[model samples]
Target: TPLHLNKVRDPDDQLVLLPHGLLRHHCCYPGCPEFLRDLRTENDLDAADAGKAGDVSESTRRNGLWQHLSPKTWYYARRSDAFLVPRVHRIARGVMDEAQTLHHFVDLTMRKLEEELRGRPAYAEIQEPWLKECVTALYGEYLGIMGV
Candidate 1:
């Protein structure tokens, strides 16, 4: 689910305000393990790829074009969530039995993560439109997995 990227040239990404029902606060426990795991998932294949039947180098290139040209790109396979989610996980471990306690922190962390994503170095440097789609699409997939 790519965001409406053509909506405007607004400096801000077109992140819509969710209806109240779609918010994580409506969940039984915000920041639950399922939500966290979804954030860590790296399984977004493009629709144009015919569910990954496309060229391997395409995915390879999408996975490759990022900061430092390394797997340390934080959202790529084997690299997903490496820098962002672990700290939250560490703190949330103590409150596992009371996962709701994480709602606020989870919310903050997610917003900050989005901010970081939008601010990522060379995140949109690719002149080709389709090749540059991964960052937002994968982020959108995680949001969907989180059921928001």
Candidate 2:
């Protein structure tokens, strides 16, 4: 069957359709085999180039042209900060399973912030505080504690 990318929800889900590349969450149960095998019984899928179909990078770059080039030039640093903290927190807990410590969470959050900040200059300035807040929220929480 030709699985279209539109049918799949996300990249990881798309990756699962490839030969033996399914992402599995380890239960880490001492009794269970080192890792329990996650069986995929369905056949829906996507092509390898699904993510490259759109001009995502170009679109982001174009959108960034209007942003401030430096943090000092930003009029709403606090507003950007406010928007970032909770968004990152929710994203970290939801995506990373809240497995890492706060320090680790913050570090990862910063990395993601930088990635998003990849716009020219203004986006970076705005992303810094939001990433920091995200890390703080996720750092101490244990797995399953995220309740995301």
Candidate 3:
């Protein structure tokens, strides 16, 4: 069976058949292994090209485009899960398993921060380079601790 490029759906149920090599570029993202597997399995070059009936040159090029440019298909053929799982896990680690308490804490903290920043007398006037840098660093540290 020939795998039609436009018919494949990704794990999230989004259609994966992007023209002009977009699929090849974005398949390396954190949660695309299932999509990559489906693409490779359905679009194998030799198998697809063997079934084509007309001009071998054009058929070969069109059929092989995904295979040629896909890093997941070429470089990590046997290790698709290995490539995607760790990154997915890292992202999931920051997400609260249960949302109630985390959401409440976040809401309260944000309100407090907003109040403190807005209450400052020099808040509008403190636009100096050092002050900006200090604010940026403080925000970064807060986010790091919050795992966001």
Task: Name the candidate that leads on lDDT.
Answer: 2
Q: What lDDT score is found at residue 125 in candidate 1? A: 29
> Can you write out model 2's per-residue Cα lDDT over 55-106, one digit (the tens) per residue?
4443222112122212323333344322322234444544464445556656
C-alpha TM-score for every candidate: 0.20, 0.32, 0.18
lDDT against the true structure, each candidate: 0.32, 0.37, 0.36
User: What TM-score does candidate 3 get on C-alpha atoms?
Assistant: 0.18
lDDT of prediction 1: 0.32
Off by over 4 Å in 3: 1-124
Model 2 residue 4 CA deviation (Å) reads 42
- Cα shift from native, residue 86, model 3 (Å): 41
RMSD of 1: 16.6
lDDT string, candidate 1, 16-108, tens digits: 223211211111122333321112113323421543786565443322122222433334322322222222223322223333433543444
Clashing pairs in 3: none
Rate residue 90 of model 1 by lDDT: 30
Report the C-alpha lDDT of model 3 over 1-148, residue by residue, as the tens digit: 0135335644433333322113432242334444344334334445445647554553333344345334444234233222221122222233323334544434443334344446553343233344333333333433454557
Who is ahead in lDDT, 1 or 2? Answer: 2
Candidate 3: residue 20 Cα off by (Å): 46
